[model samples]
Target: MNGAKVDVRKVAGEGVTWTLLATLYLRAWESRLPEPILGDRYAAGAVERIDYDFAALRRRIRPASNQFLVALRARQLDDWSRAFLARHPNAVVLQLGCGMDSRMLRLDPLGKLRWFDVDVPHVIELRRRIYPERGRYTMVGASVTDDGWLEAIPADRPVLVVAEGVLPYLTADEVRTLLARLTGHFTAGGELVFDASAPWVARVAEDFRWAPRDAREIERWIPGLTCADATPFTTHHRRIPVRRYRALYRLIHAVPALRNAYREFRFTF
Candidate 1:
């Protein structure tokens, strides 16, 4: 198969695929920046594999600090995953809502670590075709809410679950149900890292007022789950390559309400 050509039909979607493209664009944009916070080599490669007019789409969108924010979140998430991998070399890493990004490949969780990327069937099908798979890395085609898919992972090793930019789309009840199943399945206890929006942000952005009010709101839903750490969107603002944007983010962070606007949480069970 030609490396430059990908089936346009497969990548067509208004939800996950668009988000995936946005993430890839952020990585590509960051890589070209004077001083990139996260130099994701795989992102450029991923973007090439998808058949779309990325430049046109990117230009059409508002040129805000979105790319900066996206890169910051990815850096933070990748850092957390790396930290976990360093501590638990043989951990089971589950990437829920795994889209077009090559996180498993980028992280390179080599050796005893078992890595699984699970998402809806269509996305998984496209991902499997685009991304390379190996003995340690596997792709599952199932919704994260399904219980049967959880059985495919070994029960022996501790699991490190990552769901980047996923939880907000789900209803609060759905999020709680998924967490309950995960905690129940991983009785040995492990870390679950994911992002969530504040109630105000959700209301304004999605016209949904049910976003978690705080990190504690998430911990309360799952038994024996403690939010080990929570970092707001501006936590890694200093990492932004542009000086003015970095200063603006610092100012935003100083505001109490805006500081807690959107946060990523790391939970330990």
Candidate 2:
């Protein structure tokens, strides 16, 4: 809720979940900027409520450019989501690996559609404390790769599956299996939107487990899953404010592989 505050020091100590705090912090930081890309006030509020070592995390992450990129990525995803929901008001939205993201609040599609935020248990518990209860919005505490959770969600309506900052962390096989399961479950057919890193970026980012050279490569992984769009982050590099960061993005854009080193992809099944 809007005015709720909780100590999240223990949750912040977990290894994988720790990354959520960094993302939450970045969104909050960017929201405070004079002209923000994602202006997520809910994120700013959540950051304010959660008591953690954000100062130390900020120092470690050195979030100058990261803050911009994170907000921009979120803004892009939000735009796509809004477009999808507008087209199908009765759609069901599944946000996998949702973490502490305030997308449901930011979108505020209450009563307009069904929304589910799925993540691991501890993260979900933290989210329960931070976010207010809303009609037609559910929080499922299960890993995205888990098959059992899908059985509970209604599949009769159009579905929009979103997995931002999640797929690359999954093994190639896991990514393939997850997408297949999602498409299989939602027989009515819907869209899937998510961002991914290129192979080179994955190689350098030791934590990432899978990265595709081409976004369309996923078409081979799942039959009937066609890539609708693949937009490189560098395509919007001019939006970055800092001169050096913008220059870095321009340099990346000049190189073919690096151009899509990080990009967003949309697919319809």
Candidate 3:
């Protein structure tokens, strides 16, 4: 896992594992840019710690489109979370299935909020080795779908749930159960930001990529959702600071597939 090249495919048995690698790759790529959309030094460090040829891995993952999209999606998520923190500085921020991402550091909540990075035991163990624990930040080693782990987080304050690239891995039922429990537990109400694919897109994604077997109908999953809206990845492209692709990105939005394939959502419960 150090300097020696290791097969990323074998190293990561789950989709989240590959997603984490892709994230690190995007962050590393951004770091080299003159004006990066996300200045994530931690992501660059994480990539170096993993023993693999990142360039070769990019080819394997189809870097031409995937890398740019990954970076764009991440920036969108970060923007929404930052806004939430601004409004509710004392809120509890729960990052479900947090996989080696240094979002907490990137946002720097500044001890105003209780930040919890929740993931499975194995990933948590790996994160413990890579990232240092900071004040007002706790890492919970448990599956996001498990309800018991939520107990560790205090429910007194408003909550902000950031579930980027997580809902797609969960089945429709699992998504339903998780959302219901979360809304129930946080009766005081909170905001949720997550990514979801359309049913048709989900079917195609499963055949060619890593997507849940059962597509999640997010709106139906949470009937009590206060404000649910689909935000296309391209919608946030113009907001990106990178000038290299600004013109090209604006032009591509005309293609429906490029605009709506993977949509993010912001909800209130």
| Best-performing candidate as measured by TM-score | 2
> Which 10-residue window of candidate 2 scores lowest in summed lDDT?
9-18
- Looking at model 3, the pairs that clash are none
Residue-wise C-alpha lDDT for candidate 3, range 1-269, written one tens digit per residue? 44553344344434436566677777776666666666677788777776656777687777444456767777888888888888888889999988878888888735545899988887776677667688888999898888699877888888999987777778767777888888878866789988766556777675322333222344556776755556777776775565666766776677877677677778887
Prediction 3 global C-alpha lDDT: 0.73
On residues 12-75, what C-alpha lDDT tens digit does candidate 1 reach at each position? 3544456666777778767777778777777777777778777786886533467777777778
Q: Which of the two candidates, 1 or 3, achieves a greater lDDT against the reference?
A: 1
Off by over 4 Å in 3: 1-16, 53-55, 62-64, 109-112, 207-217, 239-248
**Model 2 alpha-carbon drift over 4 Å, by segment:** 1-4, 11-16, 109-111
- Sorted by lDDT (best first), the order is 2, 1, 3
- Measured by C-alpha RMSD in angstroms, how accurate is candidate 2? 2.0
TM-scores vs. true structure, each candidate: 0.92, 0.93, 0.84
Separate clash counts for every candidate: 0, 0, 0
Error of 2 at 261 (Å): 0.8
Preferred candidate (TM-score higher): 2 or 3: 2
Score candidate 1 by lDDT.
0.79
lDDT of 2 at 123: 83
